[model samples]
Target: MTESSLSISVLLVCRDSAETSLITEVMRKFGISVRHSVETEALELVKYQKFEAAVVDFNVPLASMILDQLHGSASNKTAVTFAILNGKSGRASSLKVRASFVLHRPLSPSLMYRTLQAAYGMILHERRRYFRCPIVVPVTLQKGAESEKTSAHSVNISQNGLAVSTPVPLGPGTSVAAQFKLPQLPPTIAAEAAVRWYRDGKAGLLFLSLDPSLRSELSEWLSRRMEAFLRPVQ
Candidate 1:
């Protein structure tokens, strides 16, 4: 996807309206959509919705608990989180809460902008892991030396793995070499992949070893496909 199309969803848990306004303004400039929640309803929202990042105000009675729940939630365990503090002393304390970063009281637009800029790359990287692009592509899988290769067609592709359907019986944890060329890409991509799951002639393969260059190429291809497919029906 183009840089302009890049966006992140954030859960804002600040009780202070003025503070939330400042935070949202800065986040909006960076293409981030914030879901603001008051302390009373924050916990329920945290349990269900998935967010790329969360900004919490520590003054609220439930703020620390919200951060704890975010880390404990299976879907949000790796989400980036920020703690809003009223003093510098709270900075050290926020670390114990496992916050990814800390923002001192009296937020400024420039500081917020800079902070988001620094975090954009990491947030995008995390999002890519879960972005799946559906496409059919011929894939060749080999178990080991001297073994015959199996031909398969991929059902979907993600940054770390691909799901494919083949007649060969593949058990979980079976290591195999995978080779395929993405659409519109001239070079073929090859990687060592291990079977993550299999059922009824279909299997999920987690890439074990992919060259950095080829991985980048595949990621770009998937991003472009996803962007085009998800475009609004204008």
Candidate 2:
């Protein structure tokens, strides 16, 4: 679906019927429509539905199997998957799943809402970048005496640079340093860059000095992030 036409479909799997109701209520408060299901049968149903996202129980029996199936089915479609694990036994298992985010059980409604919004924003940003050229990265600018730190979330990236989301506003011609950790990659790279433009909490940075290896690493991470958006539906 186009980014502008996108709508969120949340699959909420819970063992307790009462908890399912509470989860559904929270989703509605955020204006998100959700599909409530028992853990046992939710996996099969999810395979056939075109949900934009899923929220599942981490401790449910066959949870791994369900996650595996979902992973296989995700194609060219970015669906944010979240696992809710309350008990100690489920912690390790939840970590093993390839979910975008995981939450401990005894769910906090506010936290859940915020997490959902962030995930959705990430997915939306990815989709927009894939379809349009010159993806804008969101970045926060923190000025220092000698240099400025441009903290950015590399939401979308290309060979030129990346789109980043930051915590602070920046202006044109601002020289800054950017630091971010790539998913599944070690050793964060700090680069000298200059802000070409700025908007609210988002800014575009032109890397001043970056080695070939660092650029290649950033390209690989960008590819993986883009691939997540282009994954097909199973």
Candidate 3:
């Protein structure tokens, strides 16, 4: 799948009204279309609908209930799941339930976006590895000088940077420009990146000029891609 081809569905459950608004606002700013549902509805929806990932507020009263539903036998168990930890609970306990990632309270939009991107990227990377695709996408280090375009393929992607395949590998300190096309969105949205590494068609590119809105759009695109990929191939 190409970068533009990505789409994601996120389930946001929060007991605190302020937190909910903050999350929704960030997602909206990024142009991530979301489905707002109560905890009960969200859990049931997970059984049938395909969501790229889910964001749950572990601070809510129903947090444990939601967790059980996510880990329950009825769950499809494919979508990536994230929990917002208030720091009262131990990470060890959360890890046991298979929460892919956790975020602490007093959240920032940037942090939330980055965490989600990382979790999703990790999930996709594992899937691709399991399928053994000859081409792997990189998930980190996607920014550098604009003059020189380096050849690379993404091993995985996040809002910040992407892992790429590099030719004429350089060392860790080396720098260059990175360019690649995302799948569905316009090629005009191509990422201008900075090279973070150089090694055998594999390197990192940090996005040079992505803002909150662009990040949201990218998130939405990834969510959609996840749904499409998880769908039964017809």
**Of the candidates shown, which would achieve the greatest TM-score relative to the real structure?**
1
- What would the TM-score be for candidate 3 when compared with the true structure? 0.45
TM-score of 1: 0.64
Across 21-118, the per-residue lDDT of candidate 2 in tens digits comes to 77787666554567777666776776766666677776578766666766666542466778877757667777577788987767767877777667
- For TM-score, candidate 1 versus 2, the one ahead is 1
lDDT of 1 by residue, 64-147 (tens): 889888889887889988888877777667667668888886788887878887887776666665777777999999999789
Candidate lDDT (C-alpha), each: 0.82, 0.63, 0.58
Q: Best lDDT goes to which candidate? A: 1
Which 10 consecutive positions of candidate 1 have the poorest summed lDDT? 225-234
The predicted structure with the larger lDDT, 1 or 2, is 1
- RMSD of candidates 1 onward, in order: 5.5, 15.0, 14.8
lDDT (C-alpha) at residue 10 in model 2: 70
Q: Write the candidate numbers in order of decreasing TM-score.
A: 1, 2, 3
RMSD in angstroms between candidate 1 and the native structure over all alpha carbons: 5.5
In model 3, the worst 10-residue window by lDDT is 126-135
TM-score of every candidate relative to the true structure: 0.64, 0.46, 0.45
Off by over 4 Å in 1: 1-7, 16-22, 35-50, 72-78, 87-98, 128-136, 141-152, 165-171, 174-177, 198-202, 209-234
